[model samples]
Target: MTDRHDVVIVGGGLVGASLAIALVRQGVEVGLVEAAPAGQMPAVFDQRNLSFAAATVNALTALGVMQQLRTPTGPIRRIHISRQGDFGRVRLEAQDYGRATFGQVVVARDFGEALEARLDGLSGLTRYRPARFVGFAPDEAGHRALRIADAEGERTLHARLVVAADGTRSAVREALGIGVDEHDYGQTLFVARVRATQAPDGTAYERLGDDGPTALLPRGDRHWGVVHGVAREQAESVAALDDAAWLARLQRAVGWRIGRLVASGERSAYPIARVVAQRLVADRAVVLGNAAQTIHPIGAQGFNLGLRDALTLAEEIARGDDPGATSRLAAYAARRREDRERTLAFSDGLARLTANPSPLLKPVRSAGLVAMEAQPSLQAFLVGGAMGFRGDVPALCRGEAA
Candidate 1:
């Protein structure tokens, strides 16, 4: 059997789902293929908390994705970044920059539920749930043929544009003949919800070191979300620790920043790796989200960057008749070039620079932090990127429809 659509997106995770919402709103026909069955969320949709930049909130709000959240989200009004044993630190307040909040933190599972809800009964959307992407066949003029398998059976899907949002180990990307630059940071990040002696007070804290970076983000339930990074060699031992032992380790790593963490919820661990696609577009297809690039989680730019990719592509498709035209794909690539490159560099550089154990980098790191704290221009630049206002931003990122 064969199906047809304006766009066929593989991997209906966060980015693909967002793109569907955005494109469907523009009257585009979309086929969303997801491996997970309905009401049974994938492993990717877990209890980890995500730090949404302000621009992300704007874009998501514009797509009507934020309105369906079941749980409350915590706003980040302040950010505190310092290196372990460093003499200087940088503190940024959204109010000082004429903004009420930098961004909101939403639990990954809650956001996944909200996305599923928002996708309910949407026009111009055909969901192929519990479907697996087999591979791509020959192209038919401007359209590409996709082989997909589901409960019913195998079928062919013809799409004007095929988007691979399948994530870092993207099978669709491999079929599309796109190469990636991979980097293993040798760090494993363990995340969980924890209670501290002092409440979060709307501040997000990050302490960087070669021993591994520790971050405490505000959560909706008056608890802080802790992300403790450990060296790759020690990940197994760290993951096997009891809750009490883990909390104690966290307390030691972060000091008394948010006070002692007295308790913790369930824990999840993910190994850190950086993967950047050589090209964003190939033939009549393209990649989005982690399929296009995966950065170090230190700056929390992974999803934010991918969300921008979806929004930008949506903007291009909305403004043009040929959604899969080379011109349109080129335009999307062009629009994303500066933002993607800059954000990737920013995250990668921060990860490497902060984690370097060499004694020589300490002063340099301290000076950078001190400079950011003292100079309004430096702070503004930092805040602007954190707000997702960098490069050729799409209209949706500014709270406007494309």
Candidate 2:
């Protein structure tokens, strides 16, 4: 006899786990399969800083996941954007929008640990640890028959809907023959935690220069999380720098906005890229999270976008219809179209425009920022996008149950 579930989520990362919780709460039988063993942290859940948009926080709060976080999070009360050498500067404050804060920044590892802590408590949800998804086939009943390999060897499972929440290199997406538009930015991002001379005071800084954008997000009370983007050719050399040298380089790139960087933590670097799947849904399977689309991390939209993907799909599944029905998945894809397109464009455009060294374009970019600062409507638009308020807002995002 084959094990079965109403929905089988193929990845146990943040989005997949969140989706499983959402579905299980609705009384849907969910099976979560992860390649890593239980309690093991993946690279996605490292020391990198994760800026959760306000909408994302609401959604996670509604799902009861936010309360599980053991580590402290830094509130982003204001965002300061500027260029290396330009008169253009834009500042957005949460109070301007009648909110206490725009977003919250948490270490990725802490958030992952919170998600892991709640996984076992979810009713009607089963977790398959250290399991690899081998393949899938269509069953006679028009469902998905999944083959998963674990310590006990290959086992067959069936699901009404097979969700691929796997990371960028999703096997399920590949199995479905889904094509993607991939762009390697030829840049690398170095992330680290550093203590600055001045207290964070709930301010986040985004500095764009000829090299790339350097973002310093508030981490804890005394520490700030640094995301320094550098050319791919020089990434190795930059990453090889000692803590003092790295801090010095970061200080020069970002200026004296945050004061001297006194202490630093372990640094890690990864190449940056933009990837969007041609199709989000296929047959009885659907891809979510990084599996569906991987955006540039400039605005910290990647995980927030993925969280929305999970919640929206959950809403569709909660409709009590056939989870994998063509119409259902189609609706999910349609609902996500506008948000996905807009976010991809915004992130991609920002990465390109900010990193472009064309002196001619510098003033144009600065002028745009200056204009946005002067226009209340334009500022609101920017705030809305930053808060993850695009397209049809989901119930969870509004702090309502799905």
Candidate 3:
């Protein structure tokens, strides 16, 4: 007989690592495989950040990852959404909604390293670094056999369940015969860390221009993470410009809300696409995170939604006698449909609408923003929904304050 575990997780990125930690806490023996052993750690001065909604924060807290973060985490007191060449705008304030803050922003590298440290201390968990998933097979006995290859040789692991958190181009999902519907926006997203001439003061801003959506999200020490989308044809030109020229162009589109956008660090650009798998499950194997669905980064919902997937799966595993049973998988799929559809539609719609240069959309968008901003009840719903508080939210996402 070979070595066996309760679950085998393929991928050790943010979502997969968190899932492993959560399951291990429940006393389930877990085996995690990562292609890169001791993946490159974040540099000291790195400042890329992620905007965490309240629900996402709650999820992290439950996994004990938040407790280790120790940087200048700032609350998102307000959000400003506006379109250039339009006379209307929408504003959401936490104070108006009787909440302390809408969300908080944390440096991505910091958060990732902290989670890695926690994973190191985890018990009942076996980690296979510098290893990759070559293939997997399953039987009617409700067990999965995984073939993993590494520097040493090949080994097989048997588990009651298998999770594919391997990202957008998932090998496991492909092995399960699951296909993804991909929508290429014909655009690219540029992300960078910058020192704004003005203080963000915990305010997140989004500028929707004919070009695309440009967001300035706050980070620690007055730094900001700027994410902007540009057409594929235009992205190269934008990325080719010097820092000074780039800052000038960015500030012109965003207005003078946060003062001059000064120094910028290493910049990275990636093609944007919306990917949704036809099915999320196959036998005893299931896909989560980017494997099941990969959406545009419009509202920064990609990773947040993935976190919810992990949390929901954890809840089921923690509560059920047989975690990988057919009934349990069905329940997970049912519970995730509403939120997934809502987010997918919102992201795709926003991407298409804002990228449209049509003169006819001007009036409609203007009026819509104005109305959305003025209605208190409607604003409340938008705020809550944007912060990942809607649909069938799991208990851990509520920040139980334990």
Please report the candidate that would top TM-score against the real structure.
1
Question: Which stretch of 10 consecutive residues in model 1 shows the poorest summed lDDT?
Answer: 393-402
Q: Which ten residues in a row have the lowest lDDT in candidate 3?
A: 39-48
How many clashes (backbone atoms < 3 Å, residues ≥3 apart in a chain or on different chains) does model 3 have? 0
Where does candidate 1 stray beyond 4 Å?
Answer: none
Cα lDDT of model 1 by residue, 218-275, tens digit:
9888999889999999999999999999988888888887777789999899999999
Clashes of 2: 0
Count of residue pairs whose backbone atoms collide, per candidate:
0, 0, 0
* Per-residue error (Å), model 1, residue 82: 0.5
Give the candidates in order of TM-score, highest first. 1, 2, 3
Looking at model 2, residue 389 earns an lDDT score of: 94
lDDT of 3 by residue, 104-158 (tens): 8888778877788789868899988788888874553768898898777888888
Clashing residue pairs, backbone N/CA/C < 3 A, model 3: none
**C-alpha root-mean-square deviation, each candidate:** 0.8, 1.1, 2.1
Ranked candidates (lDDT, high to low): 1, 2, 3
Q: How far off is residue 224 in model 2, in Å? A: 0.2
Candidate 3: stretches off by over 4 Å: 42-47, 138-140
Report residue 251 deviation for candidate 2 (angstroms): 0.3
Comparing 2 and 3 on lDDT, the stronger one = 2
How do the predictions measure up, each by TM-score?
Answer: 0.99, 0.98, 0.96
